[model samples]
Target: MHTEHDWISTPITADILRGALDLEHTAHGVLPHRLPAWARAQSTDGQLAMAEAQPSGVRLAFRTRATAVELDALPTKRVYVGAPPRPEGLYDLLVDGRPAGQASVSGGNTLTIDMTTGSAEHRPGPAGTLRFTELPDGAKDIEIWLPHNETTELVALRTDAPIEPVPDRGRKVWLHHGSSISHGSDAASPTTTWPALAASLGGVELINLGLAGSALLDPFTARTLRDTPADLISVKMGINVVNADLMRLRAFGPAVHGFLDTIREGHPTAPLLVVSPVLCPIHEDTPGPSAPDFSALGEGRLGFVAMGEPEETASGKLTLGVIRDELARIVKQRVAEDPNLYYLDGRDLYGEDDSAELPLPDQIHPDAATHRRMGERFAELAFTADGAFAGRGA
Candidate 1:
């Protein structure tokens, strides 16, 4: 309702967005989701909804003649009730596929979550402005990667010149599903996530389905992969299944088969790479249902501890080592009949040797440097000449 810099407002619409598979128009603004609205409706769990709307790997990509651009958005920032304060979300801008600038919006909404009690409270805040000025002109492609951990609502866009969606450059699309590591947890920036880095290195469009505290090999998730048009597909399994203590060795095999079956229903021969979990020291020999370690809570630090003992494995408990072995065995057996199907040991990306230098900060997720390393490894292993994802036509 006010005037600033002779701003010409551009309505936020679906035409100018990428990475997001769907756009949901709300009364407040347009919310982008990795999963479509239909798929989201199936899960009433509030956690999954929040994760889907967090905009991990989601970006607004367009070509504009403008020298400056300002995006007005309402970001729903989460706060752990007793944990250390999280840094403000970072929005990275790229012009002509190169780094342009970085920004962060202040005074948006806050969702306070008390994990111990399983309670959440939401408080309204204000819409904040993020501006990028002085760009190299002459109709260049611009991408604004949203905060990977925050749920951002696209309110309005203001530009000095006209803008339009960037035409597809015909990059193969890679659809990936995994745990929080793939969700960019503990990552320095949105574009720095392993999948994002690998997508860039491999020259593929990324649709990241890596949901934090999720990716439990659900049929709905498999269906989403089946429906999405991806030239290459990878399902990083194990961690969530073990961490949640959702299934045992007896059920794990059939569930994996079912999940792959559902995805193959549509993508019968797409290079479906099955990735096992990376090395988690705590979860390697022990199982979970991980618990919070509150010893440092007074210092505002929250840590995790494995809840399952070594002896539990005898009763068919799941652990990182066990999951990795099972994933390899299952994939080896299946690949005999389905040559297009493949497997990648997640430890190849990060193992005990790599961990000695770049340890998981929280004993779970990889640090930014480790993420970069993992991305590079994935590009070499999966996307190179004659790799598992070599002959792609999904």
Candidate 2:
């Protein structure tokens, strides 16, 4: 049912890539990295390493008359040693800034992880090819959005016609940082991630730093935001800190202040918005270190449970509700001196009412529809005429 064509190979280069901070040449091909070498070198946490390598917003952007396109990529697939298999990573195609097609590759290296033991093992495999055909005729801008949750090494690019990098369209660059929810967890594809959808609706270029389980207020991460070139910036905080139970109230306030201070160093007058956690009943009033619920493992479903006690908040434990209040207070205090700084309560994006209509399937991450809803809501609140991110020239 399939036939091979005379494909013209084109060397993949940095000029055709977008959203990635760094590109590393691997044995098979080039791997996109969300974090620079110096930033990655500062952390030994395996979670941070994996998250940064997933390339949530990375994509190939070019103009071509190619009616057919083929890409060879070796993706490092992840598997939980005992959990149900995850769906293959998806690649989304956009033509002239509109959704056109989607595809997935089959074989790649596997990284099996054991949650209980915090151990992992890697097994090598070969690259797989993805092909798209029957595209419209004439020259058009084509963008291949890489998988947000997979560590993909781009091997080869081939097409029926010559290709060239797309010229800058003068879109405003929006750099956002957040947690797993912002990292496209449970989202249908990379381009449909809340931030991606919001960027599309807002008509801005995106550089997403939504590191899963790694959005802690790290100095290096702040430094990364400080140095990156962006017209608009936002930092979504609280969810990861509460779930990880990484710090208490005493440490959280100063950490947030210091983080904001670092970012202000380079972007002195850029409109900066700090977003608090969205509604999550489990850790809203209660504190956390959340843990996996193995009771449903037999049913091929996994869920999370908050491990901390509600009373623990009396002693300075973090919770989503506490975080929202604190974040609002901090922004109000800083706004007097820093007129460009602002804040948005995450609930405005995904509140209790929205959750009632679309409950989180896993009790933490939003479903595909929720991602869309959140994206639309964000565009309304932040990109509207009188919104915080409004009035920026594209």
> Which numbered prediction scores highest in TM-score against the true structure?
2
Per-candidate clashes, comma-separated? 0, 0
TM-scores, one per candidate: 0.96, 0.97
Candidate 2 lDDT by residue in tens digits, 1-394: 2356667889888899999999999899999998898999999999999999998999999999999999999999999866888989999999999999999988999999877677999999999999989999999999999999999999999998899999889999999999998899999999999999999999999999999998899999999999999999999999999989999999999999999999999899999999999889899988999888777665667688899999999999999998988899999999999999989999999998998999998789999999999999988899887787997736
Show where candidate 2 strays beyond 4 Å.
1-6
- RMSD in Å for model 1: 1.8
The Cα error of candidate 1 at residue 280, in Å, is 0.2
TM-score of 1: 0.96
Tens digit of lDDT per residue, candidate 1, span 108-144?
9999998778899999999999999888869999999
Report every candidate's CA lDDT. 0.88, 0.92
